[model samples]
Target: MIQIQEPKSPWEIVHMDWVTALPPGGDRSYNACLVLVDRYSKTPMFLPCHKDDTAMDTAIMIWNKVISHTGLFQNIISDRDPKFTSALWTNLHNLFGTKLSFSTAYHPQTDGLAERMIQTLEDMIRRFCAYGLEFKDSDGFTHDWCTLIPALELAYKTSIHSSTGKTPAMLEKGWNPRLPYDTLKKDLVDIHPTASSFKIMLDKARHHANRCMQDSFKYAKERWDKSHKPPDFKIGDLVLVSTLNFNNIKGPKKLKDSFAGPFMIKALHGPNAVQLELTGELMNKHQTFTVVLIKKLQLK
Candidate 1:
């Protein structure tokens, strides 16, 4: 997030996304799809699955990828997608004590980061993949998925970061993560002095990243949510949610009917937030939401 500080912890403010493509040259992945990109590290983990995968399967895949590498974050902001709101999936996440926020139903700002990444991914996959799996061999096919993903990750990290003028990975780890490009940089000169030795260099980068983070947070917090306070949540309160929708629509949040709710508060979150279990009506249509957006359900 350009407005956020360099992340010091996973899910401090992470982005989530999904991507699709044809099977790597030789591989025959059923769904021709994979979920990639964790907000914290900005790393791509390919979760292979089929189009028929249920909300349970998708949630399990997400849990496997997240816990295996980053444990859990304080919050997860996702779009109002059916799979994200499925009863079984919601119940499981609640068990972990992670706060989940649904972006404005039709508002793209809910998951803007993921939307941008999707565009970049499409361009990358198209460039590396053959026309309709006509590649000469499996080697070439895998090169597109595995090799290209890492390459893109590195490229994205080393590029100009809007938040700190450093890569996202750099901010997260306090140093540029190792990648294929690091090995290829042997011929390069250290134009800037990080430290006299390698260990010292890493320490210096980390320190700088931390400093940048402090500075960034100072601004981010003041700007992150400008209201005087976080939303007011209470037990048994009825609330409406403002969700973002980025499917195929183009519009403004104010104009979007993304707000869906009036669900009863299952419990009050720490202070300014709450937990809501969709009612039979909402569940029948498949709904998911976090209480951060509640401004007190409009009275009858």
Candidate 2:
């Protein structure tokens, strides 16, 4: 598990991902959900979408659904989805003051929270559709799964989370929300804030949250450091690069080699990053690969 530190408050650090490639539904030809989660509060938004949605579409969905409500966030964590990796997404975030952090190649655990949420969301949608909710569109195509998504989102928001010991609704709104199952109807109450004291209280809350986050980060770093084997790469050494970052490889993907290789290491860019010397065909395809993506080649 990659131990990433948590942000101090809701929406400060967010995770965006796609729960995808499902059988199409008739409502809007929807086949996937764009999932966004706030790391601190664990509030999640599930937007119904198609598998082929472009990077522009993703940026628009996020701005309309998320930024429209919460204003601007500080950071976004996601996997190496093409949509997230695109230059458009990078520029959009830069225009807002948010930093984009992509999970390392082949290491999904770097964005484990979002991946786990997507799995849970899939399970919820599957169960909801299995309760005899199938329907036919005007053209007689089966339209079963899309309608239950709203209900699943509602239930997920109200349920108490184990990590924070509070429902996302409570953390986001500062109170527990009353569900439809409650016989007694509850009304929303507003509290009047005293002038300077409100700011003082807010400052104290932020201080405490920051302290807790630092402690959590310390524990996680210790665990990660214990199991991590440092990459002992040297200059002028030939290494095999992982194919997970390559998209233009020839031949059937299954038959393709896992690692494209014999690239000589020219220099170390950073502790874990490397610059490789590529000549011939691979030269135009790739230039630099991280040490994590390089494996030692055995000679017979």
Candidate 3:
């Protein structure tokens, strides 16, 4: 497995992914969410989108919601989703000098940062938008996914992240953002400090955040190294890929084998990922599998 690098600054390396299409919302017609996570701050931005949106539409949302605020990013990590692989997406990022890295096919863990955020957003949307538990308008339920996203994003940003030991908002701003609870506080001390002092505090916060991130990385690497045993399979080995999400295809997933393959290993992509030469039914599908998901086929 490759070591994930820590970003030196917020928004330097952003991970992007899409959530599932839910019951369509009214007027806006938003049925899906575009999720982005900053590698450094672990801040997530959830933008409501329509399931029918084209590549251009996705680009426009990225421009408006992300690029407009943070400017251009240094890198974007994502899975090999068609929306991300399209020519429009490629040229756009190329224009901005933003490097695009795709995770090994069938290995979502490579983009786990954004995947975790997507899971959280999906859960929150189900809770509020699906259940209609949050608020109601004169016309009954709001049924507006777009309206619900901002609050959810804010909640995630303000909550403390374990890896950084600071809330995303705090890491980004060098101080916790004032919330509704603070508005009610009486005799609140002035936080406006002299320019030099403010600079010093910001520096201190960044230093502390960096230290926390380094420790988190070290612990995570150690834990991962402990249980992971590298496979001895080499080139031209036949292997079966774990059929974890094979249900996405048309099939009785439960009745089917939990693993599918015996495909020939064409090449090694990286230390922990392999390129497979698939044939028959699995052809035209994703060809790369992480080592964890691939099992060597031995003669009976």
- Which model scores highest in TM-score? 3
Model 3 bad stretches (over 4 Å): 1-5, 106-118, 137-143, 184-238, 242-258, 264-274, 277-285, 290-299
As a whole number from 0 to 100, the lDDT of residue 124 in candidate 3 is: 51
Off by over 4 Å in 1: 1-8, 20-49, 111-147, 182-300
Worst 10 residues of 3 by lDDT: 201-210
Local accuracy of candidate 2 as per-residue lDDT tens digits, 9-123: 7788887767676666646777787777777888887787888999998778777877877778888777667787788888888887778876544433243345445445544
Tell me model 2's lDDT, rounded to 2 decimals.
0.64
Model 2 residue 191 lDDT score: 37
Residues forming the 10-long window of minimal summed lDDT in candidate 1: 135-144
Error of 1 at 92 (Å): 1.3
TM-score per prediction, in order, is 0.50, 0.61, 0.69
lDDT tens digits by residue: candidate 3, 2-105: 34677898899887777665767657777877778888888888777877789899888788878878878888887787778899889988887778888777
Summed over model 2, clashes come to 0
